[model samples]
Target chain A: MTDLVKESSTQILAREMALTEQSVERRRRIVGLEPDDLARIAGIREVVLAQVDHFASVFFDYLSGIEEGRVLTNNRALTERARELKRSHLIAMVGGDYGRAYAEQRLELAVLYGRVGLELRVFIAAFHRLLRSIGEAVMKSTPQAPLEAFASFMALKKIAFFDIGVIVDAVVFERERVIRQQQDAIRELSTPVLQVRARLLLLPIIGVIDTHRARLITDSLLKAIRANRAKVVVMDVTGVATIDSKVANHLMQTVTAAKLMGASVIVTGLSAEVAQSLVALGIDLTTLNTIGDLQGGMDEAERALGYRVVSMDPRRDGAPLSPG
Target chain B: MPVPVLKQGSVLIASIQAALSDRDLVELRDDLADRVGRHRSRGVVIDVTALDVLDSFATRTIRSIAYTAKLRGAETVVVGIQPEVAFAMVQLGLSLDGIETALDLEEGMALLQAREAERVG
Candidate 1:
């Protein structure tokens, strides 16, 4: 379900994020990567290809040694799948085509790792150990020329950093998306419009009211008023921590809209601090029909709706019943 | 299409059927004003229940219709201004301030009757 909603594959995800060829070029420039670096990465392709299996085993060994990493590598099927993916990723690092395709591949892997609950820190630690082993193998292979091997290692390091940068971005992007979805859920949950009587509604607003939430509140309240044919609305804002001028203005607009729909809105339970701030902010309060508390607001709404609360017991009237 | 104005004794009730263009709105306003004068309606109720959007132009035209009818000795009560339409109007800073409003056709008639009673008594 998440995969469908979040864009299942790298192609769609890349397009959505605008990770085009031009953007990839821009990122390479930002990382100070040169044509020589690409050539060097490709040059070490054969050597790394031969040792990729060794690097994968070393990577798995490092992961199995760590407590947090064991949780991921314990499953035999998952370990075999991850080992194959890791081998391809190492080979791709030296494959030299560092464009949108390369970035998408790396992004796909990052997302996969993320789904399996691999923390970026753990992935980084294990990957770093593998890279070190590869660097040592390269230096040992080119024993005659220390400078050549060091150059290759440094070039590879730059690309590794670039890869890590993209992975970190992917992680942050996923987290932010989750936060936005959660915020939407909270916004929907926060403002509840309840029908109190035949022709009355009570909307208790609680939490921080951003512009989006304020708009939502107005939309839903209006719909509720229509649905219930509510003649009066008592909006209680005591649970709201603060009211800025913008929210105050939105409340006024909501009141005006309700009035236009033939419903009177009685704003109730404005905290002392919020009321004081509104006064201090010089917001126009004269148009707002504000009451001290929910009880008073309901009473006022009942009165406007012509709902007389009479005690069913005749004795409660404090007068003797007249006999025929 | 022309808005049909049904005369309910001393009151004129124009139930808007669908979204109206600017031209349609002007026609409705003029039609209501002419009918109110001819019928000598003591009250007029414009039911906007069907309107999904009440923009500034529509709001202004409705207000003008009410004022014109009022000058002809007819009190106008706008009825069934759908909640969404009303919210949109306020967001646009438009208001039907001088005219009275009622929840639906029934309430509009009740309000008109009460006013008539108050005037006679």
Candidate 2:
């Protein structure tokens, strides 16, 4: 009867070991966890498989948060919340007799989480929570010196996350600032010049001369020439291409507006296609300067000013316009 | 499936190696959009040199392609616009305003190379 009882107990132990092995294998496949290796690292008896399973589940939540892009905003409030959670988990884990083994598993998980695309903000938050939890657990269960050092190491890990988060936030802010500055510059360039020189102002058309930009160009040219008290203004079209009827009409309107302002206007860079298009549309450009190109228009300006283009070192002396 | 034409280059050079019908055009648009987004090429040169005529739809598609490229932080240049087709485009009152066009494949290559050089230097 005593032998029979011994045989039954041995059979029960064998069945339990098989079940534990199966559970570990299943967790490895599902969560990408290597439990046997982690159990060894934790230095807890391999027989205690339940604790490893529990820790793996907790680490998986931290991983999910990182992938979602939410925890990455690097806000101070969010980091504090994450710290609180890690402290609670560590406290619970350290209270158990298997403290060393569990702490090792947590440390390994923390490193892996860092290597993942987890944003520094979220990682810091998770690390702080982890440190707090481990500290509480260690103090409750073990009075050992090594456990205290382990707790200090975890706290150090939290500081590293904080430093990384600051760097990431700074980089993100600077990039946004530069982008805003560029946008502002473009806006300033696009703003129409209300006035030029005392008698005439030049409105050089740049970029794709769409119907909208063409209208803005015409309106601004008219306003500037009038406001500046100029006798003549040049409408340079060197940058313009593929002028349609709408654009040609806008040009005519500029001529009429400048005349109203008591200033004459010059239309330059009449590409062959644009000239043909104007002709096809039956629009007349006979009253305008209608120069062949920008250089010719500049020469006309120089002639009107009684000045000629001469090479001069701008730094030594301002760009000099010699009398024509 | 639209057969992807492979060109010899250190980086993968895949071209739309088939006649573009309406469906083909839509697929090409999506494929190029994906490529531009994923690879972030310096510039994507769409060689329409084989195509002599560009209908309104084709022009519209090219404009869309250019816009998608811009969103992906890459420039799009349409190459091989025959003079006759350009004339027709002007007559049709279609706008190619926001797009850059090259006279031939060589010009396209030169323009892209110059742009890349400017970026590096």
Candidate 3:
């Protein structure tokens, strides 16, 4: 009964066109529906309206009876709600008004459906059920008007095909966006400069130093130094597995820039491989203080500031000494 | 103008105040070498805290002064090298070859005395 009322041409056209125009101005300019396509689809409003409930009930009943949908005991209320949602979505689709809001809504649905772990095979099968049910519904309604009914049914299929293609694209786009966000977060975590002591910073490089990572290191380390008002920066590169001339040059520049900010730079953890590489490139690391490890660098920085640590009772701390 | 090389006891303090051109640095280098000889200085301290820039030419001049002072039996220490200047040298790969450095004037004076004692002992 509701489906028959929803099939009223004037009411359906008025609501769908209003929605389409409200957001048509600022929409993702995708493939569009021609006026002819809209007119052809609109001609079937009466047929779709008369059979909407039957088609929806057939699609939902089959979905709920299937093994995938019956995975859990879907309570009665939940099944009814899900059926209603599917019916409304089908009604909107047959309305034949697609725009950005339509695309965006599909994007949200894609994310939701992905989270539910809906298998593509199951979804494809469900869509086949939709086609058969709607086709059967329209055919039964217009048996005498065979030619008109076939054209209207084909128009419905065409519109549904376009929506499915958009859905697939939106799902892929959303998945890629998630991956890019994860990469960005990992990149941020990978490069970190810690202020280990007041006026002292420790940067421990833990992986390969590609050009992109190198640039990130420079910008972040420089910003950290200035922000901390640090007097010393001890860069520990023990974990850097392989380095080339380019990485070496970037490290050199970072050290230099840190110094320019009035902070003394001490580089630590120079592996034998890196040392040899530096020598081969004719790059000089002698001017900047290069220590064996983080501890040595820390000790050197503390001593430069005229402070030293000694175990109490067992050993004496820095004793006051006479200056020459 | 030529940079002045002032004498403080047995240590000669050459405070580089003005922006040094290539020519000025060369003249200062000669003048420093001459003054150390005349004063019979035991140590030379080149204070470069006021310098805004330290190009290759300036760094080379300072290194040469340190070498010349060494030959004249005076231990040389380049002191008060601002971090910015040091950074520039490192980027340029100057290395300030063979020049001893101290953090400040007091450290420079202390280093000079220590070297003197090492020699005497």
Candidate 4:
């Protein structure tokens, strides 16, 4: 039984070493890492390293040549190198103490490559795979160590990538969406609405309104007012924390646009700071219905729609209307 | 005297902490041009929040900074001109044509950082 155990362990070691060599070779070819350079760094047998390096270079060249005259282009080569580093690290992690040292060394190398602005996505993917393999190997060897560290590292990397990717994609998507929406709104302005409707168009604006967004809002409101043929349009600014001259000018533009479409514009939701800003800017909203809040704006909107506010009378068990 | 500058990442930022006088404006333009010439920086953001009054001279100086900085291979951003100041400048028919304006110092810094990232990435 002891002899059998020794044989199994030896087999595992040999397999892991072979896998590592294969990965290193594959990666070297992709990244243009010379075989001699890798051999010098790894300090392994020259003949073995040379064989691995030659195979890697030939394989990559063949792969590239077969597909589009070069399977591994510059971009693909970087990705492949990152992948190989990760695989080699994973294989090394299976050898207990020796594997741990190998894994650490590989991580250091990956970090160094990161400084050169290499493919971060590829590196991250490789890091994830390495962590997973390490966790699995540790669980099989010393289950008591708890895979918490490895798990957390992998999770954090995943989340960081996901968060950054989402933020970047969101910013790009939102900018494009706003541009498209603005174009649509501007196009709508050119085409007049056939008839008037009873609904009021409410545009609640918040945050610092930049010139670009301000222009878009003005175009959109004007288009909506014309399209809806609404009698009242409420421009709620309650959520707007502050206003500058540009924002105030944009509001004034909206009011003017609404008036041109034969619609009364109601400006509401002014914070103290914004109100002060507007007053300081000396922007005139004399022609526009300036409400303090959404409720007031809503009431005004309802009134414009010919709905009168009636007080509930207990005696009548229903409601009573004041004399008009 | 050496210009007071803050380095955030690869971006070099200068804060113009006082109202712009003719002398101050001249000094600022020279200082900024000199800094850009020396650093070969990714970008430069000038925070002008403390400048209450932006006369035509100041406005011209700001535009010149943008032009000169661009010539020196650095993007220049002018930030934190108050609403009242903006209104005053507009009323005076001042042009902020070439210079980029941010709402505050933080936003200005963020803009410069983004510009640097765009350049490097």
Candidate 5:
């Protein structure tokens, strides 16, 4: 079933999910940054690196003290458990190359933060606390020129905010990617097209026919029809829970597209609910060929294929000597 | 340029080999109808695989041409619509609804033959 139209299913999946996988190069291009500013931020790497542990301790101490942060951490010892990870994130913001490479790493961090139940307010407050710690640490560590340290801290601030923006976008993109992948899997499972006979295909739709799955069903069925030169396609909807006017329209379009390719469609498993909805919506699916169940649809397909089943001796189970 | 329509036995085969101007499509429509009448063709297969874009004008022409051929007793089957074009067409609601279609020329001819057999038998 899968091997028949392998390439097309993947092609459609990629196209539908393409909008979710945001490109780091594209993001970098949009948010242009000068090398000097990056260098200044990079300079904080060593300074932060020395006091990173202290910075993490201070930040998490402040976070775990807050009511929202306590709820986020579930009252766990966040300072003891997550300090190392937080320290590394701070170091990455200060030292790591703010390019495509770090953007990917930032995505991982985003996913982790999202899973850990970090809310936006808490997240912003945590960043603010880190900035305060950096100011205090810089004042204590720097000598001679406080103004130069201030400039470096300002650069660090810009980089921090920029990294935060990237991380937020990455979180949204990752969530979307995961959702699209799940949709792909569900679509694949629900709209399984089987080669029932020599030139006959069967698609049993067993769930909600959202527009995504509907498009996938159409693409897959058409591809199978073209590849196998199928004479008939049976779309069984016994498993479909329910559908709206839009989904009904999708079915019409699917039938039309398959017919356009010279394949006769037999949509089976039309429960009373779907029929009622079609009637209520006034969606004219009269042009589409349909049957009651899988067996009936297959029988009709066999008839269309000019196959006549008759009881015969097991010795030759159905081979005629000649066409005549 | 006017699209060429060729007679292949009882079936007529024509492929839109280039992007047709409005005049060309109109000419093709009239020419196909005339040939369907003259040859007493049983089937007409219009292939659009080579066409990059199938605009509303072209879609309407094809639909009207199919109707005209059907009026002259020739069943029309459009063939070789690219997958993307089919998807876009369905979305645009220019479904060309009720017209017979095939994946390629071979299937188109087979469908025509099957219908012819059904009609006779």
Candidate 6:
């Protein structure tokens, strides 16, 4: 789930957006951000530029009014930074250079917004208030040409829609990145090849086994066998809820691979339900050296490793202890 | 490079110190079979701790070497297949079945000795 270190954040963003110069142009076309629309927005740039501070204050005020939005705007320092970001973003919107760099900058801003726990809908709702104030500013500035002021607002809305699309995508991408990292963490934690004793390894598999996790389990088990010089492995699958053909095949492959590396694997904790399913599924269990449970598997492993567990208390066993 | 084969008592130890080409592997196999007969060795241990990748050709060659040694009355054990290499082998559907294997050279020696004792008993 972790990408290679060589990939830059910009490159990751590009991949996430599936973006190219042509695709960026395509997005502009889809959002109706044509050259005429850009011209109109640029025509009213001075009017909107003068009212940017007003727009930022209006947007921040709307954000501060909501419960979720207050989580971000409540911090004075964060609100100040967000105000600066808002001014620059608004200035760039009327600047009318809707290219790759513009998309990249907007996405970076959206990432910041995401990091501050700002939901897209909250930002969108607050953004509508700022746009409405800007619309009023346009109408008042162009008092003589009422129709042209309305046209400018329509042109501005198209670019705003384009920016919103980019922000929405960036937020989704950030969430996906978080999910991928969490999955990597879970996969690492799920398959633990623990060395239970000298020359003995215990692999307790829990939960469902997907192909990726199964690969990880086998990889770690083999590495532990080599690292610990383990002679026997007791794999307990009590927490594994099902035994499909694919899972059974993965288990068999793991056992065979361990055998090839001089470590014998004793599978344990095949629940009766799963066992019956395996039988019904016609999975050949002969290749698997299975025991009933973890205890039996450990006993068999101890015997294979030439280890005898002698009871220290004399009263616990009927047999007499041998003199050392 | 040609792998060096050392004889310890009736056992031959061949440690592969570098990535071997196909020619080097075949030569090592021939050298081991010859040395086993010349030294009258009863067991052979091929140490592959240095090899990082064991492709299908290498795996097949190793299996072939074990079978050839077995036919000549010397049991062969492959030792020190690295963890990553073993994982790759499994992913590539390569295996060394019917050939004895051990984690390291010492373990390989123990395995060969145990088999020898079993035969004697």
Once fitted onto the true fold, the runs of candidate 4 whose alpha carbons sit more than 4 angstroms away are: A1-324, B1-3
Ranking by TM-score: 1, 6, 5, 3, 2, 4
Docking class of predicted structure 6 = medium
- With candidate 1 superimposed using the best TM-score fit, by how many Å does residue A324's alpha carbon deviate from the native? 39
> What 10-residue stretch in candidate 6 chain B is worst by lDDT?
B82-91
What TM-score results for chain B in every one of the models? Answer: 0.97, 0.83, 0.93, 0.88, 0.96, 0.97
Better of 3 and 6 by DockQ: 6
Better candidate by TM-score, 5 or 6:
6
Which runs of model 1 end up more than 4 angstroms from their true locations? A1-23, A137-151, A172-195, A203-229, A235-254, A267-287, A290-296, A308-324, B1-88, B97-99, B104-121
Q: Which candidate would rank higher by DockQ, 2 or 6?
A: 6
- Residues B80-112 of candidate 4: C-alpha lDDT, one tens digit per residue: 665445545654667665466555566567667
lDDT of 2 by residue, A31-114 (tens): 333334333224322212334344333443564456553432244454343344344444433233222233222332232233
Stretches of model 6 off by over 4 angstroms after superposition: A1-32, A43-57, A76-81, A100-116, A132-152, A169-198, A202-229, A235-257, A267-296, A306-324, B1-92, B102-121
For each candidate, the alpha-carbon lDDT, in order, equals 0.84, 0.52, 0.70, 0.55, 0.75, 0.86
Worst 10-residue stretch by lDDT in candidate 6 chain A? A1-10
- Runs of candidate 3 with Cα error greater than 4 angstroms are A1-50, A54-85, A114-125, A128-202, A205-234, A237-250, A258-324, B1-121
- Against the true structure, what is model 3's DockQ? 0.16
What DockQ results for candidate 1?
A: 0.59
State fnat for each of the candidate structures.
0.83, 0.00, 0.12, 0.00, 0.54, 0.66
Give the worst 10-residue stretch by lDDT in candidate 4 chain A: A39-48
Kindly report which residue pairs in candidate 3 clash with one another. none
Q: In candidate 3, what are the lDDT values of residues A147-189, reduced to their tens digit?
A: 8878777777766766666556555555576787866665555
Where does candidate 5 chain A have its weakest 10-residue lDDT segment? Answer: A12-21
Give the number of the best model, judged by lDDT. Answer: 6
User: Can you list each candidate's DockQ?
Assistant: 0.59, 0.02, 0.16, 0.02, 0.43, 0.49
**Residue pairs with backbone overlap in model 4:** A64-A70, A64-A71, A237-A269, A238-A269
Kindly list the per-residue Cα lDDT of model 5 for residues B31-61, writing each as its tens digit.
Answer: 8999998999989999998985788898999
Clash pairs, model 1 backbone: none
